[model samples]
Target: MKVIRFVLAVALLTTLGAIQALEPAPMERFFIEFKPGTGAIIEAGVRADGGQVHHHFKRADALAVSVTSRLAKRLGSDPNIVTMEPDARRYLAAKQALLTSQPLLQSDPFAEQLVPYGVELVQAPLVWDQGFEGEGITVCIIDTGLYEQHEDIDSSFVLGGHSQDPNSQWFEDGDGHGTHVAGTVSAADNDIGVIGVSPGKASLFVVKIFGEDGLWTYASDLVAAAFTCADHGADIISMSLSGSSGPGPERKAFESLYNEEGILSVAAASNGGNRQRVFPASYDSVISVAAVDESKLVADFSNQNKWVELAAPGVGVWSTVPHVSNSWLFTGGNAYQGEPMEYAPDGVVTGQLADGGMCIAAETPGDWSGMAVLCERGEVTFAEKVATVMAGNGSAAVIYNNEPGALLGTLGEEGGWIVAIGIGQQDGQAALDFLGQEATVQSSAPVPGSSYEPWGGTSMATPHVAGVAALLWSANPAWTNVQIREAMDMTAMDLGEPGRDIAYGYGLVQADAALQYLLAKSTE
Candidate 1:
C-alpha cells in the first residue's frame, strides 16, 4: 500500500508542477526610499504610506523628532524587514543598480586588447562552420530580455512557456544582459559587425527572470526559470547572476534538472574579487567561470574557490548593446562647429576623451591643421582639457585618456561638426605631457589597424565562454557537455600556480586549442 501511495504521490507532484510552471509565482513586496541629493531614488517597494522613514538631521534643523510606533509596528510585521540593521540598504540597492547598469561596458576604453570590444569579434575563432550550429538548442538567458527587434536575435525567440497570470510571450531583455548573452550563443552570421559562435545556428530561449528595475523577484525565481528552461527543451543554460548562495527548493530543482535531464548549466563564478564563492556558481553541478585579463592573468575582481572550473577574458571585455553600435564611440560634445576629429597614433594616449571631447590625430602640426587635436590626460576631462587645445584653430576636436583611468562620456549627436572621443587616463596624461600646455604635436607613423576601444568586466567574460562553447559544440556534435568542458579546461593556457589556481583558473581559453582537443577526443 505504501509503494502504491508513493508512486501516486510522485505522479501527482509532476502533474501539479507542470501546472504551476504555466503561472507566474506570487511575488513578495518590499519598500524603498530615495536618498536625497543623490539623484537616485528607490525604484519600488518603500513608499510614503505605511513605510518606515528615517530623518536626516542635517537636512532638517530639529534635534530628534518624536518616535512614532505606527511606522515601527508596520515594519515589525514583515519578516523581510525589521532585521533592523543600519541604513545600509541604500548602499546595497545602489550596488545592484550599478551592476545592472553598463559599468563593465564603460570600462572597455582602458582595455589594451580589441577582443573585449564586443561578442562576435572576440569569440570568432571559437565558432566552427560545420555541423549542428546549436540547432534546436534552447538556451535560456534568465536576464533582462532582448530588444525584440535586434537584427541578429529576432528570429530565435520562441514561445513554449507563458505565464498564466500575464499570458504573454516572454521575448524582451529589460536590462540588455540577456540579449548580449543570446547573441554570443547563436547570433546569425549575416556579414554584420561580429559573428556569434554558432551563426544561423541555435534557438535562443529568452526567460525574463529580472524585474524592470533589474532586481530579482526572489532567489526561487532562478530555480523556477531553470525548470522552465528544461521543460522548454533547453539543452544548455547560462546564467550570469550570483551573490549569495541559496538552497531549499531552488537547489533541489537545479539538481533534479541536471541529474534527471542531463542539462548543461554554466554560470559566472562572480566578480566580487575575493575568495568567497557565490551560490549557484558554487553549486556542484553548474560550471563556475572565473575571469582572466589580456595578459592571461586572473581578473583581480573575479571570485575564486574550489568551484571555479575555468576562466576567460573578463577585463575590459566588450559585447553588443542594443541601440549601441558594435564598433562605435560616444562623445561628450556637440558638432555645432565643424566635422568630428580623428585619432592619434597608437600608444599616443592612455584614456578616453570626456564630455568636452577631442579627436586624436596621427602625425603632428600638419594633421593638426584640419582637426581640433585631442591630447592626453593628467586631470580633468581629456575632452575638456583637449578642447582648450582645439581652441587654437583646429576644425573639430581631440580626446585622450589619463595615465590610469579610462575616459567615459556621453556623445552629443545634435550635429555632425563636433566629434568626441574619450580615452584612457594614463594615455591622456601621456598626451598632455607630450604636448606641453597646447599640443606642439610630433609626427608619427599611420595608426595601426588595432587601437583600443572602451569596454570592461566579468559580464564581458561570460559571453566569451558562451561563444567558445558554441564553437566547441559545432566542431563535434556528439561530444557531451562534460567533454566540451574538459576541452576548454585542458586547452586553456595555465596562468596561475602552475596547476589550477584562483588568478587564472585553468588559464585563458584557447579557441584553436579547444577545437583541437575536441576533435582529438571525438576520434578517440
Candidate 2:
C-alpha cells in the first residue's frame, strides 16, 4: 500500500509541474488592438481572464488593459483581436539631472529684472503690445499638474482641469516642471512675478497626466487627457512629453480633436538630441517644436528631424516653480561664469579665494578669512571641504568640477557652511589658475518673494509657440488650425541653411510676423 501511494504522489506532482509550465507570465498593462466594433467583446474576454480594462478607444478599435502574459497571448490569438502590445511608459522631456536650485524670493524684485528672453526672441511681446494677449482664447497644458496658486499664475484664468490618476490633484504641481511650463505659456501679468508669453488674458487649463512621485504617464492617460481637453473647449493643447513609439490610438484621438473639433496641438521635439523622432510630436497633425538658445541657435540638447516644425528659446529659461529657497551662483572677474548650483545655506556669504580657493591640502587656520574658499571636487565630501574652509574663517565656499560639465552638490548639516556654489570644470580651473588674483564670488540669498525658477529643455520651448498660437487665434478666431500653422511656418525667421532643415525647422517661430501675416490675409 505504501508503494502504491508513493507512485500516485509522484504522478500528481508531475502533472502539477506541467500545469505550472503552461501558465502565462504576468504583465501590468497592455494595448490590445481589436477588430472594428469588437472592443466590448474583447473587453469581456479580458475580464473573464482576470484582466482589468483601463480605457477603450472605439475610433481606433483598441483597448488599453492590464492582463497576465498568458492572457495577453490568449487575447492575441482571438480572431477579433488584431494585435496585443505591452503598454509602454512615457516621460516628461525635462531632464532631472539638469535641475538646480528652486527659485527663491529676492529682496529687490526689480534689481534683477524677470526677463523671458524667449518671449522677446520670438517677438510675442510685439503681439502683446498690439493688445492680443491671447484674450478669450483657451490653452490646455497637458503635462504634470499646474500650480494654480502661483503668484505668476492667475487662478481666475483657469477654466478647470482633470487628472487621469484619481489620486492626483488637478490644480497642484507635485513635480515642478508643470508649473514652470504653465508660467511660460500664460503666467499672469500681475507685475509681481515673471510674465508669460500670453500674459494675463489667456485662459489656462491643466491636465495632470503624470503622477506625484515622478514625471511619467502611459499612452491611455495621455489620450484621456487629450479628449478631456477637447471636451472642455481647449483651443490649443501643449504637450511637453514624448516617447519613441509608432502611431497608436492616441494619434487617432489627436487627429479627431484637430479635424473634428478644430483644436491645435503642439508637442516637444524631445531632448534626446538625435534625429530619432518621438511621438505624438512626430505626428503629422501636431506641430513639433525644437529648442533654441538666446542666440537663436539650436540647442545641443534639442532633438532634430524632418518632423520638427518650429524652434524656440529653451536654455536657462526663468519661469515659475514651487515656492522654495533656490540657490543661485554668480562668479565675477575674469572667471565670471553663471550656472545652477546646489547647497544648504545659513545665509549669504561673499569673499575672494585664497590661493585661487584650491583647498587641495588641509587649510591652515585664518587662511580663508573674509574670503570665499574654492575647492576642487575630489578626495572630500562637499560638507568636509566647506567645513574646512569655515574653520579657517571663510565667509563662503565654491566647489568646482574636476571634469567637464556642471554638477549639483550638497553640503551636509554638519558642514556649517553659510553659502556654497558648484562651478563647471572650465570655470573652476579658471578660478584655480587665478587663485591669487582679487575676484569676488557671490551666492544668492533667499529672499521671501515669488516661486519662479530657471530650467532648460525642449519642454520649455513648446509653450512659447503654444502661447503664440493662442495669441494668433485670439486675434483671428475664425482661422482654421491649418491656416494658423501655415501662417506661423511661412512667417518664421528662417535659420539653418536659409530654409527648413532638421535643426531649426522653419527657423525660430516669429509670433509677431505670423500675427501680422494673418491680419493681412484677413483683409483679402
Candidate 3:
C-alpha cells in the first residue's frame, strides 16, 4: 500500500510536468519605441530576440513587431528601448447589420426627409443659410471605405482615398457604417434621399483603415492610416473608432499631425457606457465627441468621462445607406391597430404595431391576425418574441426600447416573422400607456429607388461635429485648429449641470452658434 501511494504521487508530478511543458508561450504584437535614428540597431535587437518587425514608423521613431512574452521582457531591459507595449485592437464604433439581401436602391424615396433631424438639431441649416457649406476644406474620414456610388454621396466631392489593406476595395463599402457616416458629413444637396451637413462644400478624403469585416483594425494599421491621411493634405481627420488602451505611438502620430501639420483630429468618446477612458479620443490632441438624442438628451450608450469635450445628435439619426431595399417606415399612435403590415410580399414585410401596449409572452397566442404586435424589449430574443406573436397569427412585430432612447435592431433571418421595426423607450411607453384605447402605429418601405435608414451611435455623432468643423474652417480659413475647437466648446448649448459635466460635455454642438461666435470673434 505504501509503494502504491508513492507511485501515484510520482505519476501526479509527471502529469504536472507535462502540463507545464505543453503550456503555450504568450505571444503578441507590440509597438516598440527607440531613440531617434536607431532603426538599424532596434531592428537588429528585435531580430536577435526572435521578433519580426511588421512596420517601421520612422516619423514616430517606433516599430510594430511581433514577439513572445519572454522575448519582449528581454527587449524591455535594453537601455535603448523607450517603451514596449502590446499592440491593441480597435473596433468601429457603430452597430451594423450582419446579413441582408437588400440591394442598394437607386432612387431617393425619402427626399421629403432630406434635411435629417441631426442637421436641424445642430443648426447646420442655419450655417448653410450663411452660404458656408465647408467648401475648400478637406476632411479625412479614416474608417471603413466610402461607397462612392451612392446617389446621396457626391463622388466629385471625394478628393481621393487609399486603403491600407491590399485586399480591400477602397471605393466600395461592404459594411454600411462608413457610407452612413460619410452621408452625414457631406451627402450632396441634390434634393435626393437626404442632405449632408456640409453638402457639396467639404471634400472627403477616405482613408480606409478598416476592412469589410465590420472594420476591425489593429493599432499598427491605425498609425499608418493617420500618416497617410496627413500626407494627402487632410485638413481635418474624423475617426469613429476607439480602444480601451492608453497613449501610444498612434496617439503620438495624431499629436504630431495636429501640432506640426495643423490638422484637427476628431474622434468618438466611445459607446462603452462607462467612465473608463478610450483612445485616441482620450488623447489630449484629439477632440472627443459624445452622443445625444433628438430630444437633446445624452444617449445611454454614450461613454462619459472628463475627456468628453463635445456632444452631438446621434440617436434616431436618419441618413443615407448603401443602395439596398433596406428602408422602413415606423409610425404609431392611438388608432390604426388593425392595419396590415405592408412590405414586399416575398416574405419581406413592412408593418406597424397595435396600440395594445407591450406584448409580452402572456399576451401572445391571441386574435392578432393581420395586425402587427408590439413587444417590449427584453426577456427573449427579438426573433423569439416575433415568433410568439406569429404563433397567434400576428402579421408583424415592433420591438420598443426598454431604455431611454431609440434602438436599431435586427430580427435575424431565422425568425419566422414577416416584418419588424424598433422604437424609442419614450415612444414605446406612451403607446403602452394607451393600451386598449384608440391608437395608430404603422411602418412601410419607401419607393424602390430611394434608400435611407436610421442608425444610432457616437460614430454617427462624430461626423456631425466633423462636418461642422469643416463648415467653420471654410467660413474662417484663417482660424487655427485650437481656435476652431475653442469656438465649438464655448458656443455649445450647455446641458446637464451648470458647467461642463461627464454626460453632456459642454452641451450639444450648435453649428450655427459656433459659426456666429467665430464670426463675432473674427470681427474683433
Candidate 4:
C-alpha cells in the first residue's frame, strides 16, 4: 500500500509540476518518549500540530502517536522529546499456523476428562499428583481476551484493560486465540473440556492486545499491556503474538518489567518456519518458546534461532474455545463434496465458487477474496494450484480430478495452506449448477457441538512455558522470577547438540523436574 501510494505521488510530481508541493505527506504511527514529567507537554505539542495521541504510558513517560512525516521530523529535534521509532504492527500467525478446529455434533462420554497431548507432554499431571497445581500463582495472558463465561477457565478474577482502549472491558474474546491460550494455562480440571497445566488452581490476569479479527497490533500496545500485567498481581506473563521488529524502547520496557517488577515473561518464537528473530520472545528478559509436535519433535513452522529458550507441544494441541456460530461449508442444501485438502486453515469462508479451468499461476484471477475457486487437476502441481488461488486472495480452492470418480488425494508431502478441497471430475462440472450462488468452506465435523478445539502455532507453545513457570513458582513461593527461570533451564530435557541450541531451546519445559530442581537447590 505504501509503495503504491509512493508510486502515485512520483507520477503526479512528473505530470503536475507546482501541485506536487501541495500534496499532503503520508501519516505514520510512532512511539514517542519524553523525559519524566514531560509526556503531557510533548503530547500537547503533537496534538496542536495535527497529530493524534493513540495512547499514553504515564508510568514510562511515553506515548504512541500518529502524525505526518514532517511533524515527526520536527518532534525528533525537539529538546523535550527523548526518542522516537516507527511503531510497527505485529500480527498473529493466523495464516501460517494450521488452525484446525471442528465442532462435534454429538457429545461423546468417553471424551470426558480427555487429556490433550500438550497437557500430557509437559507432564502437568505428574506435578498434580504432588498437589501443587499452580496454587496461588498468577499467569497473565496478553492477547485478544478470554470468554469469562467459559466453564473450563473458571478464573476467580477477570481483570483486563484493552490496549486499544484502556477504559474498555477486555474480557470478550471474539477470536478463539486468547481463549485457547488461556485454556492451556489454567483451564479447570473439571470433566468437561481438556484441563490446563495449572488445572484450575492459578489466578488469571489478562490484557487484550489483538483486535477481534485476531490480526495485528502495534508493538506499543504490547508494551503498555505488560505494565498492566505488572500493575496487577501476575507472577508470569504469557504472550502468544509475535512481530519482526523490536525497538530499543520496547526491549527496555520488557527488561524493566522483569527486573523491576519481578515478573517472568514468556512469548512465542513465531511460526515463520525460519530463523528470523521475532519480537517480545527474542528479548533477553523474556523466555522464547518454540513449538514441537506430539512426538516431541520440533515443528516445521516453529522458528529456530539461538535466542529460543524452550520447546513445548504445539501441533494439534486440544484446548478450549469460545462459543461461535457453526463454521461449516454448505452448498445446494448438501455438505460440500471432498475433504480438507491436507493443510487447509480453519476459517469460515462464504462466496461464489467460480470456475477457473486449470488453476495455473498465469490464468488465476487477480481478485478471488470472499470466493471459492474451482480448478481442474492438471497442468500444474496441486501445491502450485493452491498457491495461485492464495496469491489471488481466494477464500478457498476446490480442485477436481482430471479423470475419474471422487478425487481423493493429497497436496503432495508438503501440503498447501489454503482451505483446499478435492472433488470428483463430475462434481467439479456439477458444481457450476450453482455457479453464481454462494458456497461456503469451513472446518466442520459431523457431531454434537463441542466447546473444545485444537490449534497449532508457536502461540500454542507459549502457554506451556508460562504454565510450567506458574507451577514451579507455586511449588516454592519463596523463590524469585530469576531463580525459577534458572531452575527451569537446569532441569529442561536437553535437546539438539547436548546443550542449548536453536531448535529446542533448553528443551521442553518440565514441571516436575523444575520443582525438584528448585527443592534440591533449596536443600543445598
Best-fitting candidate, scored by TM-score = 2
List ranges where model 4 is wrong by over 4 Å: 1-25, 94-110, 157-169, 324-450
Clashes of 4: 6
- The runs of at least 3 residues in candidate 1 whose Cα sits more than 4 Å from the true structure, single-residue gaps closed, are 1-132, 154-169, 324-455
RMSD of each: 18.8, 8.3, 8.9, 9.8
Give one digit per residue, the lDDT tens place, for model 3 in 355-474. 434455676655777665677777666656666777767776666666643344555554245666665556566665544433233444322232566677889999999999999999
Q: Give the candidate order by descending TM-score.
A: 2, 3, 4, 1
Candidate 1 on 433-468: residue-level lDDT in tens? Answer: 333232222222222121222234455566567667
* Ten contiguous residues with the weakest lDDT in model 3: 98-107
Model 4 over residues 1-524: C-alpha lDDT tens digits?
99999999998887787677777668899987778888888888889998999888886778899999899889989898888989977777532222122221222222476677777888888899988899888888998877778878785744544545443346777777888898889888888877888888888888888776677889888887888888888889999989998866788888888899899999999999999999989999999999988778899999999999999988766677775323344677766445455555656678887877788998876788778888888867777788888888887888776664334334654554777776656667777677778898775432322366557899998998999998888887889999999988888888767889899999998888888888998999
Scored by lDDT, model 3 comes in at: 0.75
* Candidate 2: clashing pairs of residues: 102-326, 105-447, 105-449, 351-372, 356-435, 357-374
Q: Looking at model 4, which ten-residue stretch has the lowest summed lDDT?
A: 99-108
Give lDDT per model, in order.
Answer: 0.50, 0.76, 0.75, 0.78
TM-score comparison, 2 vs 3, better candidate: 2
Q: Which stretches of candidate 3 lie over 4 Å from their true place?
A: 1-26, 47-50, 96-113, 326-385, 393-450
All candidates: TM-score: 0.57, 0.77, 0.76, 0.73
